[model samples]
Target: MHVLPQVDSSPSLPRTKRVFFALNDYERRVFFPEYLAAELDALNGEAHWRTDELPSPAYWQTMMQELQPDVIVSCWSTPAVPFSLANAGSPLAYVCHLVGSVRNLVPRTFLERGGLLTNWGDIAGKTVAEHALLLALAALRNQPGWRPIINGPKAVPWRSGTMRLQPRSLYGRRVGIHGFGHVARALIRLLQPFDVEISAYSAGVPTGLMRSAGVTPFTSLLELATRSEVFFDCEALTPQSTASINATVLAALPDDAVFVNVGRGPVVDEPALVREAASGRIQVALDVVCKEPIDPASPLASLPGVILSPHIGGPTFDHFPHCGQRALENLARYLRGESPEALITPELYDRST
Candidate 1:
């Protein structure tokens, strides 16, 4: 346990809100630097931090009952906020998450009871879109083959004709995006310079909205896949979207079409995607997979026409401060009795990855 020095203890000031930091040691250092910690300390509150990465339930319960924090700053390693601490009668009112996906750290009942919650939100959208573009370009150029071609036993000639990987270009390509959320929108901006024709399909997103963004909106995923030379999966993970990209969708892509996914992996049928790539019918570049830190037996580990990354598609490590700052800003707003940005709604929560 650690506590920031109280900056104000005047009797006339409003009651000092108790702010708890439910982060492990590593998360604390990464998300809250000294300056950010000082900034948080500047708020009209007392900040108490948790040192344990995996505290016992009894320990957490005891701490919560003792501190009765009005706000909690949490991250990936933090445990789920207990039910007793999230009710209407509890003083705990807000949770400022330093990263995405509050579903693990927060209970749905917390929001259902009028408690506030905020995460990094769309701050990492541009980063994710940037990675999606990288994956597409890499897939078209056959990036995975370069290493083997250069280091293999066969001494291939330096001449361009000697190279066997038939690399392609992104110029004038027909690009189809499966989702029109933040990442997809940012990807559109990046694709403009490539002179690519863009089309998009999201379950309920209006075509008018896509048209306003200067992209054709398809009503069906199959139609989008049929027409696209490059297919991007950016759909969120939800009951409806899970396994939506099945064998039929994979079979729809034009031959040699590059497929990219920087979004949730379960959105696509993993086995179907694997079979498609294994057959050399389509090239794949994925930053996410259905089983993260992928199972060794997964075909993705050995497929030739596939490029896989360990889900490093967004807001790289250096960007932690930005998320921390956003959390601080949201906390400041809540303290000021002003509405916070990126408040997690029930709809957003229902669809979180």
Candidate 2:
């Protein structure tokens, strides 16, 4: 009769939600360090970390069943949420992704089934915009060819006027942004000091919004390209948008116009872009390509006028903690029966890469 002491099973007690960190080593170290993990663990839940490489689908399913996570914080190397696990009435209620493009990490059915999803929305916009400016300035100033000029056999060609890669000034340039998303808006702000005339073209974006932002909105991409001295590709990737920057658009750019892409690559026709760059008609600076870690043998890699960055445009390494903080904020909001920021709607999911 030494029965169990009175157990407090009161309904007033807050329920604990299980949280799973589906991130690899690098992601864990950079995106979620000890302090951030502790912050998450302090929430009303038990936090579990996956330190090893991605597990097999079957293993993931088993783990999901065992832990039955109510929230998952995922990152670059995290495996895609299996369709079966997500669709078959799984306990997964929300997924807070620490980076962009959750298409690879999440399934469409997750949203369709009323599960909440969010990404580090607009947190990296300013940083990416800064990189876009860097690429534009580098291309305009012939940064790719500076090495030979600086290390040449001659001491220095005093008052060198006939440099092979002629430098161009970005000041007072006609800049056209292909999309008016967060990054594009940030670029507009950065370009304001230069007094450049900015025009933008995005399929569904309203002209009034652009006008309010001091931008000239174009109804067509070709029109924007034809008029721009510097064209930035910041459009999202979708089925209809694939290859939207085709031969016609590339051909429309003014001679020597700088084409910078900090956006997805498939939006541009790689072959056409290569042909344009090879012709020496335009300078191309890209942070992305059709294929990631672009093949060295690719023609785009050899062209002197083309400057390529290994897709480093983003909230810089130091800013990764900000993304983690955003994810945590969203998780807290969700736990409080409030809507999370940057909830990935079905439409947004479709619009993403």
Candidate 3:
């Protein structure tokens, strides 16, 4: 087994740090090539970008032992064993691709061991929030079933006794944000132009900061849900928060109320949501699901009023470059014996605890 030695503590920083990139096969093909090039240029580092072809954990261990990179930047979809191997006192940064909790993808043991995590929170915030807003707008406009009308030039005559669609303007409407993290803050900023009344529910967030961002803080989740036309779930996933969206909360939503979830799938109860959406009691737009790449036969897919996307809330052309630049900057800091801007500390890991 080959091993790369740790960087020596010297006054002068190395010109180039040997870094390893481990990612899923799809990410490697679709996103990593450009990201790798950009990251190399940003950090001025010699990168060893590897796409793992091995079948099992043993193969990954072998590869890590041989590469012995100074730092490892990885996606959550890849196996954690390679990360565990490389993280034996080595600098490891987990790069978040979107706005979802990390608990689902990373093991508790990994967090306990002091693994550093980073994300494109600042850059990807507006992008994900915009996607969520788009979903809400589509739901409000009743666009899911109007594909034929939109695609065709023919206009249908209005019929009495049919549901009269009154488009609701976001202006002056109360918007409730479930989580007050980076993406939530960005969403609040975006909503400023619309003149919507914004309120947020968070346990640890400072009230002054939220107020400064033009969001009114709500102490109760139930109150927040009861009062808003649109509710955006941006909270992280944890044991407590997992399956947090229950029937009672779903029951409180006013008729034609819209639920936008760009967060984790497990954060909302899919079965309950399906029931509510099927009844036409509440509108739902989901970009994430409890099961990713949801099976074609899943009831959520066939539901009449639900707008389902294949977990693409954070996808945009800019995400790749933004993530790459942040990852490289973190690597550069690690080479200089300084903490990376995106580095995750043990305290953040303990947030779940």
> What lDDT tens digits, residue by residue, belong to model 3 across residues 74-142?
665555545554345644433333222444445545556655555554666678888888888888777
Query: How many steric clashes between backbone atoms does each model show?
Result: 0, 0, 0
Shift in Å, residue 111, candidate 2: 1.2
Q: Provide the TM-score for each candidate, comma-separated.
A: 0.94, 0.93, 0.80
Error of 3 at 190 (Å): 1.0
| Regions of candidate 2 where Cα sits further than 4 Å from its true position | 1-15, 35-38, 161-164
Which pairs of residues collide in model 1?
A: none
lDDT by residue (1-353, candidate 1, tens digit) is 34655756588876678788888888877777777766766665687777677889899888898889999998887878888998778899999998887777888889999989999988888999999998898888888778877786656566542457778899999999999888899999999999999999999888999999999999899999999999999998989999999999999999999999988999999999989999998999999999889987889998877898889887888889889888888888887888789899988898787
User: Compared to the true structure, candidate 2 yields what TM-score?
Assistant: 0.93
Look at candidate 2 and give me any clashing residue pairs.
Answer: none
TM-score, predicted candidate 3 vs. hidden true structure? 0.80
Of 1 and 3, which scores higher on lDDT?
1
> What's the C-alpha lDDT at position 321 in model 3?
56
Deviation in Å, model 1, residue 233 alpha carbon: 0.7
Backbone clashes in candidate 1 total: 0
lDDT of 1: 0.87
Runs with alpha carbons beyond 4 Å of true place in candidate 3? 1-17, 23-47, 51-55, 82-115, 148-164, 350-353
For residues 1-353, what per-residue lDDT tens digits would candidate 2 score against the true structure?
01112224358864466678788877867876666755665465556778579788788877777877878888888878767557747878899999998888888988888998999899889999999999999999989888877676685664473467678889999999998888999999999988899999999999999999999999999999999999999999988889999999999999989999998999999999999999989999999999999999999988877999999999899999889888888877887789999888998898887
lDDT of 2: 0.86
